[model samples]
Target: MTDLDPFTDLLDYPMYVVTAQADTERAGCLVGFASQCSIQPARFMVWLSKANRTCRVAERADRLAVHLLRRDQGRLARLFGAETGDRTDKFTDAPWHPGPGGSPILDEVPAWFVGRVEKRIDGGDHVGFLLAPETARNLTGSRTPLLTLHDTHDITPGHPAN
Candidate 1:
């Protein structure tokens, strides 16, 4: 195991479903590498795996949508985390609508945001998309329980890590 694994494996990370649209093509995937990076200007970042189809589409996209699923939405998490867009139409099975910049906003999520892609950073096996929030929604007035890495241990990623 890598040195980082010892510390990293002890923590559970929140998961998100990130979607991107470029031209007529749409793609999305379950991501664990995301967080708010700024407050004054309000910026968030999501890291897309280089091996996933979502990264390809996100590369050409002007915006992206990030969705937070409830604790009970394990089925939706499995759909995005274990399924590959290369051979599967994930949107066909889920409910969604077009948001700002034509990003797909999953209808089942409790909280979400559409962000303009401000920059892309190449970080090893993942590409980090830095976003400036354009719009955000919180369907639940209170904090909702979220799905996390600890809850998705059984899902085998649809693509290679590298």
Candidate 2:
């Protein structure tokens, strides 16, 4: 197999905070793997590590909210990325409101969308949630620079990828 690490070393793809709600349980995590996979049908996919608590909650969640953080919102990124949800209630410090299907939507994000989980695909260490967007909100007029992986190098993952 060819090494794919080098290909993404210079790429600075935008980061996202993915939140989910199942029953009374809620989980959110900083995600690096997500993208719009379709055009006409308007589909998106977010990959969550199986080891993370958010992935566990997301398994039972009917919907997931993907939030786009601005370049200046690095604190929110660290809050979601560096802390593990297993031992902490991440929502206590972060202000949010129930969104489509009751998924938690961060109030501080520049843009966000709630999508129904259409399918879950097994992808080695991560599970890809295929989403069909139902509701979306954009407050930045699509002009704000988004937080990217390159901006989050200092923080460590709350859960190990493998």
CA RMSD per model (angstroms) = 0.8, 1.4
Off by over 4 Å in 2: none
Alpha-carbon deviation at 43 in model 1, angstroms: 0.7
Error of 1 at 161 (Å): 3.0
Instruction: Let me know the TM-score candidate 1 reaches against the reference structure.
Output: 0.98
lDDT of predicted model 2 = 0.94
lDDT for residue 32 in candidate 1, whole number 0-100: 94
Clashing pairs in 2: none
Cα miss at 29, model 1 (Å)? 0.3
